[model samples]
Target: MKHPKVINLVQEPEVFYRIQNKYDRIISVLGGSMQVGQVVNSDIDLIDITRRGLPKSVVITVSLILGISMEKMSSLLHVSHRTIQRKGDDELLNVYSTEQILEIAEVISRGIEVLGTLENFTKWLHSDVRALNYSKPLDYLDTSFGTKLVKDILGRIEHGVYS
Candidate 1:
């Protein structure tokens, strides 16, 4: 008998908060928030370390660092807007069909280098030194949570995980 496929619930608030916790932890250990002056340097450092070239993952990193929309990055990369949207959608939705998983696996296997030392992963959770400085009230947390999730994902990548 075929078992029912387990549906992954995309509960935005809870999911975002969890991502935020992970991201904040990384930044805390890293000393401070990454600044504009440091973005270029950090990007190059990560690129050299990963040596996997840029893929959908880079788009997310670039977005967080530059505070730009995914659409703009998609245009620059010459990848379709839908593809960009799909990546973010999948991330937020936390849904990975067999086909998408296969695609991700194929991409990473192409140049599987370091899988991120545990130490590196810890560095990403710290507070932002070159912070975005986006203010938010404590009462309204969902927005902050989403930002945290994005930051956390970046931290994971810094640790060299494909996520």
Candidate 2:
């Protein structure tokens, strides 16, 4: 019998799919007259947008997407609710606030993607999570570490390993 030819195989360091997430295209989280054609496709794009600042309407849109009140959104951004409400829709938010809002939108997008719908993800956000020591995921929204934790859990849930 002839010896079989063996082919050396190497795995790719990163998987490349021709397809990309549609979410990155619309970035609907930045709602209100945002042109979906201009997508946030890279870290540099994210940084540039952050430096440019987001409109005040982003806060309102994200709050609605999250089904939370502006008062709650205000507390998360560490700003007065009145200040947020007083700002015009076209007014740009401060860099720090813009960054925070962007981060939150990222998490929201991931959660919705993983959970299959915004309604389901919103419910999950408010529900107490066992891995989070019975604290609601919403409670973790105030801190960066906690937001990361939420993202990790969402990843786990996506992979079917979240117990």
Candidate 3:
């Protein structure tokens, strides 16, 4: 008689997270906010969206809430010091910090399954400012609770879900 194979749940964060996330995505899809394929495709699109929009917002929000300097934020995000100035807001210097950019980068890096080349990441970072603005992309933030939601979203994406 042969015994069935046993699955170890403690040895792999990716596998553990994948199952947990798939369950969560199933529930969310059933709720009608997303389709089944979208959940699966999210693995790819999330990296795309993150590369395209999240970094700037993460840097901006963190700097704003922490009241830090843009030069610092740039160094931390590995972006040019001029990037913040280009945001068209003098106040941005008072909001972002180097530490915050590092924190956000670490979080985002974990979810990037198919990392583009450095040039690709840089190009993607500066894309479609008009779309980013109209998405009211940052409106999801206003308070600590909102920030928590952003963190949660990142966690979901890392795990392969959105909830």
lDDT of 1 at 15: 27
Model 1 TM-score relative to the real fold: 0.23
RMSD of each: 16.7, 12.0, 16.5
RMSD of 2: 12.0
What's model 2's overall lDDT? 0.70
Compared with the true structure, all predictions reach lDDT values of 0.31, 0.70, 0.36
What ranges in model 3 sit over 4 Å off? 1-42, 55-57, 65-67, 88-163
Clashing pairs in 3: 63-95, 63-96, 64-95
Angstrom error at residue 92, model 2:
0.7
Ranking by lDDT: 2, 3, 1
lDDT-better candidate, 1 vs 2: 2
How good is model 2 by TM-score?
0.80
lDDT of 3: 0.36
Cα lDDT of model 2 by residue, 65-158, tens digit: 7778999999888889999988998788887887788788778877767887667888999898999998888877866787898999999999
**Top candidate when judged by TM-score against the true structure:** 2
| Candidate with better TM-score, 1 vs 2 | 2
TM-score of candidate 3 to 2 decimals: 0.28
Error of 3 at 128 (Å): 39
